[model samples]
Target chain A: MIKNFIVLLFLFGLGMIFSALLLGYTPDSELNLTGRYYAEHTAQDLGAANIVTAIIVTYRGLDTLGEVTVLFLTAAIVGMLLSTGAGKGKSLQRKLSQSGELLTTGSHLLVPLILLLGAYVFINGHLTPGGGFQGGAIIASAILLILLTDPLYRFSHQLISIVESISGLIFLALGVLGIFFAGGFLDNRILPVGELGSLFSAGAIPIIYSLVGLKVGAEFSSMLVNFSETEDS
Target chain B: MVTIAMLTGFILILMGLYGALTNHNILRMIVSFSVANTGVNIVLVAVGYIHGRTAPILNEAVPAAEAAARIIDPVPQALVLTAIVIGLGITTLMLAYAYKLYEMKGSLDISKFSELKW
Candidate 1:
């Protein structure tokens, strides 16, 4: 009972500390210097209507690259750990999972539409709030739906791996292209900024976002496949 | 409103931390840690919020010239976006580790794996 009381007291202390911090925090009534600068410059400088996208893809492109690499490494580590235990050459093997006809047909119909929507999301990323990560997750969720509905359905390891590698390579090549053509590595100023808010504007942002979307999708699908094909499960 | 969001985030973090500290099952601990992660993301985004402001996008709703005065911080949002992805990576890695532990010992209770306990 004393121990329980101590835990409660500790928790209450923690909650009070957090509440104090929350109270002390002043929500900005005005745009601060960094915020103001990014807001003013993003559209004119990057030719991207979506300031967030400009900030994410061009201003902080290196961080995004590192983020993608971290995901890639995670996927690789998961695949390695699972592959050794789940047995060799069986990662891509199909299970005997059967589904209702409605689910099967619905998945077949929905898959292409989901892929299209994913493409649309990344393509319009420079003009909209959605971007590569969101679109990639959507596409991966579509794959997940199929995996759930049809457990026997086998995703081609070769195709997914090829897509993943190519996209990463393209992203790196685009960054290198930045060094030769623009301000620095990952710079989006290589091509003409073009008309603002247009589909073809934002230089390599949309293209880079599309590649990121594909790579993220493939990596997620690879991880899901690894989880599904485990030996003990 | 921003304060409310921040408060909610802090509450979530506290709850998640409590659950993680008390949970004996490895899976539950992972779930709790993920909850804590989500709380952190919400707090990060909340910290960047401003009063009477729109998103940092330059569209018809928010004109380009007026954006400096009307938009919230984009840097925090960008940082949070990357943090969210990295959080997922770490969670998945922990899950894989949990799975390996379960497979090795045929137990999910973290207490049972206290081989290094002094």
Candidate 2:
């Protein structure tokens, strides 16, 4: 009872401290500087209504590219860790086959639609609230659905690895092109900005977002596969 | 209205904290972590909300200048989306590790799985 009382007192004190910190906080003016300018200029200059996408893929495209690399590295590490033990592969396959047909058919019906939606989100990211990350997650969800419905459905390791590597290379090539032809790395002005709110506008933002979407989708799918397969083993 | 959302978010966070603190199972702890993360995400989205505004987008109906004047910030939405994905990835990884540990030790209780201590 004494110990419990002490713990409760400690928690109360911690809560009080956190509340004070929250109450004392003020929004930094400096943080608003870029956000304000970005909001003002994104539509006029980049022709993208989604200021976040403009910031991510145009103003800070390099950072987004780097972020993709971080995801890639994480997938690699997780895959390596999960694949270390693999004795019951055949049994796992059998268990997967027996899971039922409803899941399989439902996932089949949904996967294509999810993929299409993901593509749409990334494609229209410059014009809408959605972007590469949102689109990529949606795409990943499709893959996860497949993994869940069809346990026997094994992703071709070679194909996923090849896709991931090729996307990474393409991402690098685009960045290098930006450095060579544009203002700096990932500058979207390499091609004309076209017109505001047009699909063809934002130069390389859409292309880069599409690439990121693919990479993230593939990586996340592979990670899910790795985790599920490990469980079966 | 915003204050209500903030209060709800805080309540969820507190509940998650209580669960995490009290739970004996590793899986429960992880689930509490997820709840806390979601609560934080809700707070973030709520903070970006403005009255009588829609998402930041330019359509033929709304001119670019007028659209900018009325749109709520999209940065937090994008950031939160990224955060959600990252959180999902981390959660999956944690669950995977937990499963592996369970397989090896035949237990999910946190108190019994302290083998790495020096």
Candidate 3:
């Protein structure tokens, strides 16, 4: 009872702090300096319709690289942590009952469409609200559905690793190319910025983002597969 | 409207923190942490909201020339995107750790593992 009281007391104090912040907060009527700069310059500088994409994929590309690396590390660690003592005595495993026909058929029908949508989202990252991370998550959800339908199914870890590696390498290579061919690292001006709002505009952003999408998708799929493979152990 | 969102976010953070503090189950704790993570993300995005502004996308409706006056901040949105991904990574790591703990002790109760307890 005393422990619970202490916890509640601490929470009450934290809530008081939060309420103070809330009461003092006021919505900005004008864009701040950094926001003003990006808003004013993104289209003209990067030819990207989506300012957030331009900021993430170009202006702050190195940070994004670090973010992807962190995600990779997380997936790798999860795989390493869970793979030990897994899949032993496969012959002794109990057979899982077959998934319902409706689920099987639905997953079959939805997987391809979901994959296509993920591709579309990342491909249009420079023009739309969605981007590499969102698209990659969407693709991972498709893989999850497949696993759901067939619990015993095993995805090709080799294929997933290969996709992840190649996309990461290409993403880095494109960033390097930006230094030689464009103004700076990860600059989207390697190719012509093109007319704004066009599919091929934003120079290297769409390509880089697409590569990021594939890499993230592959990494997430690898983690999911590693997780599912542990079910037998 | 922005105030409402921020208020909801703050409330969620408090609720999540309270749940995390009180929960004795590892799984429940992980779930509470996720709730708090989401609340943090919401507060972050809400901080970037501007009065009477559209998204930071430029098109015919929001012309490039007039973007500064028309759009909300994009930086916070980008930061929130990163935050969400990192949050997912952390949640996954916690779940994996919880699973390993469960495997070790065959229990999900936090108090059962007392090796680190003083």
Candidate 4:
């Protein structure tokens, strides 16, 4: 009863905070200075049609780098936790029931298509609503499909680690290259802005996003692999 | 209106918090936290939505020169995207922790693990 009372009190405090914020906020009729600046200068500066991509990849590249690192750290920790003998491995001598042949065949057909779509999403991120993170998740889900249907399927841990490490290295190099070639780190001016709205435009932004996509995909795949390796999947 | 969305998100967050605080199952608590994180994402996105403008993209539809007049703010959307990915990572890590806890104790009850509690 005391715990419930305390919880209700905390919730009431939270509710008060929300009401205060709601009372204070006013919808701006015009873009504020930062928004206005990004809106006006993003296309001209980054040559990317998607302003969000331009902001995420160029204006705020360091933050994205940190976000990717957090993902890497999570995957690493999960890997460590699930490694042999790290967690209690009960010897359950039971085999998982086989998935239907039709389901397996359907997943086999759909996996490649999903992978292709994931590729398309990240590749076109500079021109559309999607980006590296969304694309990476889609790729991970495709791998998840295979894991669910094929009980005995095992992705090569070595291969996944290799993909992850190489992409991360490339991402770091791209940031370092920005320091030398561009105005500063991740300046997006390193390459010709090119014509706006073109697939090959946005200079290194698309490349960076693609690298991020690959790294994220690999990290998520590693996590899935870790989770599925348990005695009971 | 934006208020409606924000209100809904706030309610979801409160409900999630209540669920997390009251639930005895570790997995249920984790799920409640995820729900709260989702509420946060929704609030962040809704806070950035403008009345009638399009997304902050420049093209034939929204010209480069007049983008400020035609588009919603892109900063919040970018922040929310990053937040969502980080949330996913954290959720996965928490689940792994829960699984380890279960493996060690053969139980999923949060109340059962009182060794660290002073």
lDDT leader: 3
Q: In every candidate, how many clashes are there? A: 0, 0, 0, 0
Question: Of the true contacts between chains A and B, what fraction does model 3 have?
Answer: 0.90
* Model 3 alpha-carbon miss at residue A103, Å: 0.2
Task: Please provide TM-scores, in order, for all candidate models, with all chains considered together.
Answer: 0.95, 0.88, 0.98, 0.96
lDDT ranking from best to worst? 3, 4, 1, 2
Candidate that beats the other on DockQ, 3 or 4, i.e. the better one? 3
Report the C-alpha lDDT of model 4 over B14-82, residue by residue, as the tens digit.
989999999999999999999999999989988888899999877799989889999998989999999
DockQ of 1: 0.76
Spell out the clash pairs found in candidate 3.
Answer: none
Q: Which ten residues in a row have the lowest lDDT in candidate 2 chain B?
A: B1-10
lDDT of 2: 0.75
lDDT of 2 by residue, A1-233 (tens): 67557657765775676567456644332324545566678777777767778877878676677677777777887887777766656545454335567776887789999999999998888887687787878888888888777666778888877877887788778878888888888777777788887888878778877877778878887887787677553
**Candidate that would win on TM-score:** 3
Residue B77 alpha-carbon offset, candidate 1, angstroms: 1.1
CAPRI accuracy category, model 2: acceptable
Across residues A164-217, which tens digit of lDDT does each residue of candidate 4 receive?
Answer: 999899889888888999888867777788999888899988888998999999
* Better by DockQ, candidate 3 or 1: 3
For model 1 the local lDDT of residue A60 reads 90
After aligning candidate 4 to the native by TM-score, how far in Å is the CA of B60 from where it should be? 1.7
Task: Report the Cα lDDT for residue A12, model 3.
Answer: 91
